[model samples]
Target chain A: MHSFESLSKDFAAFFQKSHFPDQPASLYQPADYFLGLGGKRVRPVCCLMGNELFDEILPDTWQVATAIELFHNFTLIHDDIMDKAPLRRGMATVHSRYGEPTALLAGDVMLVVAYDYLNKVRSEHFHRIIQLFNRTAREVCEGQQLDMNFEKSETVSLDAYIKMIELKTSVLLAASLKLGAILGGAGEGNLHHIYEFGRNLGIAFQVQDDYLDAFGDPDKFGKQVGGDIMANKKTFLLIKALESADPALKAELDALLQSNHPDKVEKVLAIFRACGVDEWAKTLKDQYLSAAFQHLDDIAVLSKRKEPLRSLANFLVQRDY
Target chain B: MHSFESLSKDFAAFFQKSHFPDQPASLYQPADYFLGLGGKRVRPVCCLMGNELFDEILPDTWQVATAIELFHNFTLIHDDIMDKAPLRRGMATVHSRYGEPTALLAGDVMLVVAYDYLNKVRSEHFHRIIQLFNRTAREVCEGQQLDMNFEKSETVSLDAYIKMIELKTSVLLAASLKLGAILGGAGEGNLHHIYEFGRNLGIAFQVQDDYLDAFGDPDKFGKQVGGDIMANKKTFLLIKALESADPALKAELDALLQSNHPDKVEKVLAIFRACGVDEWAKTLKDQYLSAAFQHLDDIAVLSKRKEPLRSLANFLVQRDY
Candidate 1:
């Protein structure tokens, strides 16, 4: 079994080749530029890992993995425009650098190219993979819409927020694994377990992300420790703190949300600490982590074969950054 | 053989069913609303007609038909956003009514739903249909980018403009026919002929559309004559006139393009007429129409089976609107 680092490198090397035609540089260059900006390539690697769990990885798995990465970048481009974000991955976003219209079209063509890759998969696995992809893609859009709605909403229940996170963030991870497993010739039972494992792992990672933003060392995390707090962005810690805070504490948190004070993040962190949200967040992350492992364990594969995924999950959730 | 009108009604009835779920109203509602504002369901109906030309229309044809319509609307929503178009089908465009972010997501989900419908097609036909759809979709995006690029360009060649029009408008119509014909068990030769027929017909219709905007009676056209002129939109007449105009006429046209004069449309039309572009446009339209019919005649089907398509092509290009 390949480790996450090794598989990520393989995926990266494979993906270094361009997926788009060079013409209409106005439209495609931005797409190429954004893909070049690069990330950990975690989702595509997850796909490879999923395939490896079942059998020696097939050629089709690489095609699907490319599709997942392209689809993920498509979402990021459009999401950046919608969010009016200026930077991503510590650089100018596609919209910021290339302008919104080009960025929008770039995102669109990336999606089309992603499907072009999917269509290249051998026909026996093509229909099921496309169907699962469609469902997951639609859910991701719905999740984005819900996330936007939550911003204007005065109150969002924890359950609703979690659902949004699942739709926006987790399902793609889950679907990536499932897509690879489908191509790997896994049976239905193993498919479900792998998907659940991915879904739960994604949630745990997100929780840990939120926890790091609030509490981790800034130098270690490589981001401002309270950037989410400063923006009044919704995250697990803030949502849970709202739900569990006393009336006085809730009022203070609300005021902090309304302020542009320099101390806002510090004050919010204090309220969160006062309400035990910090500890609660860790507990929530552990719960999801355990659920993830439980699902992973239930998969009908030799435990030794699962080591790569096991270590990957640990690396994802146990990180400070 | 189904007449375009009859098949249109059939498509309308089938499409009255919602393609999106209700939970995320912000995302799905704009999509639903945009689909509700009916245009002539030309592309989907073309799919059905293509099916009938080879054999009895199959249930798979309807599914592919739905996919075509959904995909077409998906483009319109995103295009409207990119163009900042306020109105569509005599109503507010999706972005104008629902806001850009929601509209963006709506378009995204609509595309995903389109694939969902396509995935419902039987596996034997699914792979071919998806490959064609992806290629056509990518060309459409490239065409849109080229159209936008032409807006800022000081000069656009007639040949380049025609290619852009083909990409932006003609290919989807062509692919719609090809998709249906594939499902109808069309042999490869007939598939090429039908696609070419649709392509040439689309170009002819677009030329006629530009002609009507410049010269047709507003009462018949149902749009203000010279609206494209007011927008300084590049059309066949304008581009061709620029290419063929003498130096003096060219200077006049250039001046008109820069001004927002109330008589700008009249001045541009006068230059177009002086260059004999009006007559040239008529000849050009006829050239494409004749080519379309030639391909239609070439299709290896009973001549009688070709009547509906031939008449529909006439109705499209010959109409003032």
Candidate 2:
């Protein structure tokens, strides 16, 4: 199996070779800018890994990887607009640099372009790939809607938050792997198993993101460690804290959450520790990671062939930054 | 062949039967509202007409029609955001009512849903339909980008303006017809011919719109007659006047175009008449209409079977409002 770095290098080289039409600078320029901006390109790497698991990487795998990457970037462009974000990948966002209209158009064009690539797939794989892509795309939209809905919502359940993250972030990863598997000629059982592995790994990664937001060392996290707590985002930690705390502590936690205290992050951390929310999150993350590995193991492939994916899941779940 | 009214009625009824998922009101509700605040539903009607032309109306015709209609509404939602328009179909624009973020999300989901319906076609027709849809969709985006570019540009030629509108508006109509024809089992020759028919008819309709904006009776036009002139829009009339005027007349027209004169409409109309731009517009509209009819004539279908589409084209070109 190819190393993740090598697979990503191949994906980047393929991407560098890809060309966008140059006219109508308003539309394609922003698309080009956003795509050119650096990202981890995790989804495409996952897709490549999935393809390599069952067979030698096929020609169609690159097209599927390209489609997945374009679709991911398309979502980011629009999400930045919705989030009113000023910077993405340490650069001005599409909506911020280009106006919202053009950014919107860029994202729209990117989506159409993604389908353009997906349509290049062999006819034998066309129907399943498109159906999965359409379903996953719709779920992403639904997830975004739910996230927005939660902003106005006064109370949110841990289950609801998990579901939202699953829809928003996890499904695409799962779909990417499944698409690669399909193109790699994996059978139905293997396809489902690999998809579950991706989905579980995604959920585990998100939980790790939440846990690290509050507890990760500032030097290693690559972002402000307590940013989520500061913003009072409804992350897994807060949700679990809210769910598990007794009435008095719950009220105290709520006050700390809503307060403008300078030490608000410290206070929130204290409460999270007191309620064992940190431990709960750790346990949940491990459970999901274990579930991901089990799904990976269940695939009817050689143990040696699964090494790359297993290592990938370990890296994703165990990452510090 | 069925009358356009009957086909439209069936189309509308199919639309009424359509259901969008109700949860996450922030996303789906705006889509519901925008779609419910109806336009003429012209694209879907055209699609149905295309399907009816060569073969009996197939079940997939309605699905394609729904997809076209949904896609049209999606574009309108985003276009209204870019145009900053206050109303659509005599109702508040989606962004104005739902906020830009929600409206943006609504458009995104609508696009995904469009594919959900599109993916339902038999796999035999899937590749061709999706390819055509992707190409047309990208052209629409490019056209929108060019349109936005024109907003910043001071000297847009008539050719550029026509091409912009063709990409922004005409190709979708053309694609609508072609999609229906393909679903109706059209030969490639007939498909291309019908698409060309729609394309020419769309351009002719837009030119007629520009012409009527300057010259039609206020009572009959159903909109402010001089709205385009007042807004300094580079309509066909203005482009022609700019092109055809002598040096002195051109200087005068340029001054008139730039001034915020209360009688700007009258002044521009006078200049348009002096330069024979009205006649020019009429001639161009006729040429396009004639070209549209030629494509319709070239279709291998019987002339009697083509009558409904022919009448629809005539109705589109001749409408006073």
Q: Model 1 scores what on Cα lDDT?
A: 0.91
Q: What local lDDT score does residue A34 receive in model 2, on the 0 to 100 scale? A: 90
The TM-scores, chain A only, for the candidates as listed are: 0.98, 0.97
The residue ranges of model 2 lying beyond 4 angstroms of the native Cα positions read: A246-253, A256-259, A319-321, B246-260, B319-321
The interface RMSD values of the models, given in order, are: 0.8, 1.0
Candidate with maximal lDDT:
1
lDDT of 1 by residue, B49-135 (tens): 988999899988899899889989999999999899999888999999989999998988888888888888984777899999999
In candidate 1, residue A52 scores what lDDT?
94
Task: Go through the candidates in order and give each one's C-alpha lDDT.
Answer: 0.91, 0.88
List the lowest-lDDT window of 10 residues for candidate 2 chain A.
A17-26
Clashes per model (N, Cα, C within 3 A)? 0, 0
Tens-digit lDDT string for candidate 2 (B179-204): 88998899989988999999999999
Candidate 2: share of reference interface contacts reproduced? 0.90
